[model samples]
Target: MMHRVAGAPLAFAALRSQLEVPGDFAPAVRAEAAQSAQTVELPPEDATDVPFVTIDPAGSRDLDQALHIAASGDGHLVSYAIADVAAFVRPGGEIDSEAHRRGETLYFPDTRVPLHPPELSEGAASLLPNQVRPAVLWRIELSGDGSVRSVDVRRAKVRSTAQLDYDGVQAGLDRGTLPDPIAALPDVGRARLALARKRHAINLALPEQSVTGDGAGGWVLALRTTLPVEQYNAEISLLTGMCAAQVMLDGGIGILRTVPPPDKGAVQSLRRAARALGISWPDGAPAGDVLDSVDRSDPRHVAFIEHAVALLRGSGYTPFNGAPPSQPLHSGIAAPYAHVTAPLRRLVDRYGSEICLALRAGIAVPDWVRVALPELPEEMQKADHLAHEVDRAVVDATEAWLLRDRVGDVFPAVVIDADERAGTVVLDSPAVRARCAGADLPVGERIQVRLVTADVDQREVRFERADSSQL
Candidate 1:
């Protein structure tokens, strides 16, 4: 069942305006992007015969990475083709300056503020099927155990055989009818996941709350669970990123996506919550394993997973030159990582890819990249903050709209979090998570909650324990 809201577009527009989100490209930027799209040069190396396929959300036009995996002497060769935004966006050019200011794409429920003009992001530089586009191709050689043997990145002209989506790919895998180019995805993904677990990587299988357009001029708020194939696809990207981080570290200059180790206090809190929720977290078992072992469909397990999100709080971009940062690890991955796979949407990926390409080719890092390294962290942080705010606001507004007509009605909910005065609850139907106020609210237990206020204008939804308030 879907919970829908009418006139959501107006609210979204107001939110965008209030947040000062970038609206449209300047005339010069648009002209530059259009001209580059028409006259961009393709790389000399031809990888069109590799039969690469791209997997992303359905109807995604800004295609980023394409992949083709095949057997190689009891191992696997993963040919990953990333959109070469550098080919079209000259350093210090109009697109480059604008992308730096924006840092990354800002997504909304109704639309997105793209980092680059759609001419390049969605048309020319995108790795669309049947179109020969310039790409930064990573030829990753992995052993039978998913251990990396060698990594090579270079510019090339590539054509994707098909543009697949997560749902279709998952269905194909279940039916054993996936195409030859990506048939080994399951095996490779599993191997990489095993390696991740061995390293104590933290993988949270949390349900995503998203707002989508309803058929008629309204919006629907829904909860989505990650499919197995999606996790497999993510493993491939993570593999490429870890390899990129190693190359940059060896080369002695680049930025990294870093996170400090999870707080000791947070881990303890999660362990206690797990016990209260009746989830089996074995003695000394890493949180990731316990999370992976839970049944995601259960209310108590879902509540436990929600509490575990505290472990992923302090992620940020860490740029380094000549000397590495003191804390270089992304704690969740339990390894050093770089963002080099999605140049079409993110500003840093383009720079990170350039560093890897030059390092792999035994050349000096470009002067433009060196000049921009120190500033990237701040820019990306600003963008991250704005993106988070926009996402939260949209969800809040949608939740308010969903419950606007049902004020005073009661629903079954699981108290996922609690403190002295208030807490948070997750409703089973309509998939709403909102603030609740009551004395001594029980954590990790199912209870009845009464909707008190659903203020769409304020983008607030609040509830009280059903027994604490009288209708």
Candidate 2:
């Protein structure tokens, strides 16, 4: 299902221009941003002494989440702080409208089109290390067994004690020498993951491809595995989102991130896929449990995980005012959830955090947040579509450029999917997936594939079965 014409441009300039992305802010947007720094009010709580630290990519400045975990009486207290984006952008202002138009931050290869102006999202609102920032703080208390005991949301002022990345944190954890204040992340994260599994949470195992500088005026696609501490860190955000959804449901007014359970047909298809791949998915085992047992480093298991991604679709934002929805589960997370973290990068989190705050404080939900609840679904859905398109386009373009001169080269590839017309094969060296015209391409089987075409202008690539191709 792909078309390729080699020797096109090696840069993303063509794709960015082709997509016609909004690359600059409007005059009105700029005007509002200049005033926001002075007009934006901060909350009246100073928790700077809590020793919170920002953990993100090595050089990332748009830090959205920071935390300080400690052992409380028979449990742990997780003081998770998220950037308070709503506090800076006034409702119906130019910044607000512009953010709605953008919906969310779009990250490309080397740059990003931020939802809000840099003054706020990156400079002021961001929780940079050692900087005092306003945040929507989640105070979650958990029992010894990792079950959540209570949750509280509030507006507060805080400062990050340090900025740490996953690799650094993992190294520290491995050596058992992380500073005392932040040493509790692994323990709490593992406990929370245990609770998630108890409720059937499904964590997909797939390597992600990232583009990095080649140091010669170009980029290279790198396939990286998700580190153990990274998953542990993500479990914190998941715990907060689940707590947010529960609060919204109990308060009877908010939006939720929802995904319906997989249907009988999807499950049947997955079972068939597993059998075709010669993977034994036990008859009565839950899909999550079966998936957790596979070694992801194996190509066959990668193909199985690829098929598993299809079972977790139909995701969307659902808003209600007077009552909770009957089916509000986010099947991927295996729990009810909402977007209450990463407000600096996302829009829904700002409104959801506001609603949760109001509900926690026994105050009326803000009129502005109430009005935006129903409208957020459409906005977020559209933004999500654009983000996905950009992501796919960038990857396709990069793959084409990387393979431009190797059209006749043969490589080992595993079959990810197959249909009557063609089968999708993934090459390990470049870590790119391309559809190859073939027959009897058994799913998950490793075979020789030759690159037939790679076109950067069209951002397409096609392959052929090297077993019988015109070598």
Number of the top-ranking candidate, with lDDT as the measure: 1
For each candidate in turn, the TM-score is: 0.97, 0.96
lDDT of 2: 0.85
Model 1 lDDT-worst window of ten: 1-10
lDDT per residue for candidate 1 within 263-304, as digits (tens), equals 999999999998887888888898888887888778788778
Ten-residue stretch with the least lDDT total in model 2:
1-10
Please give the RMSD of candidate 2 to the true structure: 2.8
Indicate the residue-level lDDT of 380 in model 1. Answer: 92
Clashes of each: 0, 0
On the 0 to 100 scale, the lDDT of residue 6 in model 2 is 33
TM-score of 1: 0.97
